[model samples]
Target: MFAARRFSLYERAFGPVVTPITSIRGLLQDFTTTAAYDAAQRSRSNDDYFATIHHISNIVRRDIYMERTLNKMCISKIVNSELVYRVLRSCSRSGIESFRFFNWARTHHPHYDPTTLEFEELLKTLARTGHWETMWKVAHQMKVQNLPISSSIVSFIIEHYGKKDLVDQAVELFNRLKSFNCPQTTEVYNSLLFALCEVKNFQGAYALIRRMLRKGAVPDKKTYSILVNGWCSAGKMREAQEFLEEMSRKGFNPPVRGRDLLIDGLLNAGYLESAKGLVRKMTKEGFVPDVSTFNSLAEAICKSGEIDFCIDLFRDVCKLGLCPDVDTYKIIITAASKVGRIDDAFQILHRSIEEGLRPFPSLYAPILKALCRKGMFDDAFSFFSDMKLKGHPPNRPAYTMLIRMCTRGGRFVEAANYLVEMTELNLLPLSRNFDLVCDGLKNCGKHDLAKRIEQLEISLRGD
Candidate 1:
């Protein structure tokens, strides 16, 4: 009797178990057909999600009674928090409309509760549209909800105000942070400092830094960089140096070395010689500069038409225990290629690989370009093939570049082959490239090949 009762209970809970498909064909179809159906369903669901948002945006934009119309459509039942946020983003430029949609979601949608994501997104949207009064109202609402605004938002607003030359407003915002229940952090201070620097209010900017220290908020790398950069931009290197020294005396070394900060400042200020001299002194004394700091200097020097000098500097820094990054190799390789030093470019490329860096098109394309420039077509082809063989295949831009180089050299057959190969790899060959190859082939009396190229374009485009 207990066994019968147990079986009855199981049947009530799970119902009778459907018999599993026993045939091989049925089992295969269960996996293969069901999986494909599921994938298709997901694709359709994604399409519907975007379509729904677009439809809502259109209504919000055109209909005066958009909220009522959405309600009558039973949007409250279907709408979710994520859907509401997406719709807000879609109509973001329409600040009033975006706010209405957000408000509608909160009040009307059955289960749609606004989160911090929606709140911050609305704040940012309102701020972007210069809806200052409305933005404050939203902030007040956030405080009511116990959600204090983020420091990032403060920084963005300050930067915006600085861009519009509203320095006073930026300051007002900084001073008003306490009322918003936001703590005055380094980022908040940096924004104000940046605003001061924008207006060349160096005196005020410097004072702000001292104020930061007094408030027990330590200035970070960005703080030092900003002040130093501002001073450097104004050609007041002496004052910048004095400020650094004074800060050092106060037991506040920057997160990065002060010297690196100075170099970066000098570089931004267009005082390349001062930066170069400072770097030389550091490296000469066996002090390794930050790779990024050195890279900035190296990049700047290369642009000044002294790539060879930059290369020497790269080697000197490497010897002093400074490992180079991908960007470092990219800079030297590009410079070498531009000056027709293919051999040196090749050596740099290999060196970067040996240092455990993968090759990118920008890194190797220059060498191919240099080879092509010097009529070393075979070498360029060999290099490209070798790259593919070693698992670092060129991307679309690189393929387009190679095809263009081939066409330029009257190698239409090779160009046509590459065009096919690119398509085989699922890269869309531009229609213009197809026309160029077809025309070239026709002009060379290779009509058969030209027809094939034309047919391939038509097929790929599904026209």
Candidate 2:
């Protein structure tokens, strides 16, 4: 988020409000703002400031009775919201300790006062550790301080409660949002639905959706996805379709089709077989699954070691107007390489590039591994060089893999050349790498190259 800046009197004036940046007044204000920004950046980088937060966190983490210890330290200045938030996050796992530290920061630390950010973070930390009572206490404090608990925070809390299976508490929070002056927006409703679905309370989730409809709040895509996912997880696909049809009948059409929602949900709930069956059926009908859902299905199927079936699905879907994304290519390429299908992997890589996607090291590293596995050293080296010169330069892991393979293949001179190449790229080969190349060179009777590798390590280490 952009930080808030202090407005100057001249800049705040009505005359300059309409003035362009070319004006003298505007230029002066810009310089002043820039200088303040620089000073703020320097303050943020100060080690002492961070060390202070760390020190306070250590004390808070040890015991919940932080006020007395923090008081004795006699902190000389007021802490801002960000500092307070950082310390609270540091003590987040210990809910009681975080609350105690927060109380001290707001009430005893000089002229400090907690803002919405500090209050929200404290509540989130408390919720994270299942401190239900203390979380409400903080919410009440926020309300009493005339701070409205934003709907976004309410949604987060509800989502956390759902993950913990505390559906009742989640419902309670949603019901009491009016007390906190937070409206029951779509976000809050969706969060409650998620919590209900987490507990397999789809009936309750459906009721909540009804309430949202009654309140005239439009159901967004996430709302539809959540309910559909719940039904699919419960093995109630028939009910899921009926629900979508009902929504459509009510003139509440989801942004996507019902088929995509069901397929994605099946994939998420670990029903790979069911998802695959639906995908095959859909493609058979010339109906395209959503690209995101297709990519997810492909990734999941590839992991099951049925790469051929997944590749067939990829082709079938693409023919049916499903455009594969980069993730789709990555999954296919990786699985192809894993199965020693280097030619297939190369074909997928080229297709990704033909689709105008930038080729990256990850997209080709597996091919290098496959080549090395097959002892095709020349092919691996050529591909690595092409990737560096024509595509994105290979990253450290790629270089390391190539180096290790070279040593094992008795290509000591080539390995030494790569060690030098790494230095040119400002990528440090690992200590183990230097040992591998040097040992291989010594055994192969290339002492001059071995000495060069050793010197390279020494120069880089500045020893």
**Best of the candidates, TM-score:** 2
**lDDT on C-alpha atoms for all candidate structures:** 0.84, 0.83
Q: What is the lDDT of residue 305 in candidate 2?
A: 79
Best-fitting candidate, measured by lDDT?
A: 1
Question: Per-residue lDDT for 1-463 in model 2, tens only?
Answer: 1011211211232222222324556556765877778876788778778899899889999955567788888674637788888898888898888887787776666577778988998988998898989998998888789987888889999999999998988898888887777899999999999999999998899999999999999999999999988888889889999999999999999988889898988887889999999988888888998888888888888888799888777777878887888888888888899889899899989989999998888888989988998999878877887777885898899899988988888877777777777776789999999999899989988787677667667656755
What lDDT does model 2 reach? Answer: 0.83
TM-score of each: 0.82, 0.87
User: Tens-digit lDDT track for model 1 on 1-463?
Assistant: 4223323432332333223333445656765777778887899999987997899989887789988888877666568868878877877788888888878877875577688888888887887777778888888898899987889988878877776678999999999988887788999999889889988999999889988999999899999999999999999988989999999998998888889988999999999999999989998999978989988998999999988888888888888999989888989899989989888899889999998899988899999988888888878888988898988988888888888888888878777877877876889988889988899889899897788777667656756
Consecutive 10-residue window with the lowest summed lDDT within model 1: 9-18
Question: Clashing pairs in model 1?
Answer: none
